[model samples]
Target chain A: DAGVTQSPTHLIKTRGQQVTLRCSPKSGHDTVSWYQQALGQGPQFIFQYYEEEERQRGNFPDRFSGHQFPNYSSELNVNALLLGDSALYLCASSTELAAGELFFGEGSRLTVL
Target chain B: AQSVAQPEDQVNVAEGNPLTVKCTYSVSGNPYLFWYVQYPNRGLQFLLKYITGDNLVKGSYGFEAEFNKSQTSFHLKKPSALVSDSALYFCAVSPTLAGGNTGKLIFGQGTTLQVKP
Candidate 1:
């Protein structure tokens, strides 16, 4: 079975711009969570979506938002991107039945110049 | 607030030697700990986790982690290290709210493991 997949593997944007990254959860999974990994650091949680509604969120500001479609695919949208927003955005998928473990995608590299 | 700490920035070990990567976590109640490995230009891969069962949990590859409740630590261990084992390791904790797993992970800064041949 295909694992989690993300689109726009690499992209660049200037400050004040907005970017949207996409993800398709692994087959048989219903939850999608987004994470941001800065250079030389581990990933920080952004938010998680289940049933097309946000179930949990991290410390990120309102500028970061996400959407989950009926098919369980997700999209992460970052508005007014700052230079510090540049990082690798990872998408992970899991099921409520398997609560703790997650399967991640290759991630989309965003460079806010 | 839930958090994870991987004190070492990097660890080096010779091939065929044993290796251990240390991790400690802090959370309100029972913590769900996890270990993930990331290779260059790759996403984090789940290694193992400590939910509610055995203190010693064996996972993918040759990785095993020991959970010490008193110490609040979960250290990953391997009897023999391979050169290919070199990668960035992350320790994470899943926060529980209202007695349910939120599925949100708080990750450590990560430790780079170098297994020299």
Candidate 2:
């Protein structure tokens, strides 16, 4: 009955450094998607993982990558982070294909200082 | 490309007053619309969705959204506003699975709602 869960409620990183955020999808869910939300702005799609492979990606740079574990958990890795990388990284999970109603995690706040 | 617009950056209303947040969408086919809310420094919470069938769809937290095909709009409404209702709202749209676009959603810029006492 647990909802989506994320780790390390917050993080601080510097330029050129790498950061990895974690997420566990809601029970009975198998697909995971990542999104980035900047202050006062809406969330933007990053990428989606299904069947342990990236099914789709957004306009993000190659520096952004993700992995979906066999257990349906996900990790979002951002390499060579820039100041602009500072934002709230949210992970959403859904079970059925093309079903846009997603259950989202609390999200990890990444601060690139 | 699919897109959504929330024209009002902010909407303020007194407690107990009815509230409405405007949204408009653009898509190549039938739209699968959604409304989500975000509290201070939190992730987005699903409020409701409009996929098909009735134009009126009700969701959690006493929220309801009306899907208007002619206007290409999905506006979120609440009969009575609560002080705790203050938050940021986002409208999103995607071509429904039947309409032939992937399930990926395109979201609006977000609107800040302030329900004052």
In model 1, the clashing pairs are: none
User: lDDT per residue, candidate 2, B30-91, as tens digits?
Assistant: 87889999888677898999888999999999999999999999999999999999999999
- Find the candidate with the highest TM-score and give its number: 1
Measured with C-alpha atoms, the lDDT of residue B74 in candidate 2 is 94
- C-alpha positional error of residue A22 in candidate 2 after TM-score superposition, expressed in Å: 0.7
The DockQ-derived docking category for candidate 2 is medium
TM-score of chain A of 2: 0.97
Tens digits of per-residue lDDT for model 1, B26-100: 887887899999999998899999988889999999999999999999999999999999999999999777868
Candidate 2 has which clashing residue pairs, if any?
Answer: none
Candidate 2 chain B weakest lDDT stretch, 10 residues:
B94-103
Q: On a 0 to 1 TM-score scale, where does candidate 1 land against the true structure?
A: 0.98
**Residue runs of model 1 more than 4 Å from their true location after superposition:** none
DockQ of 1: 0.86
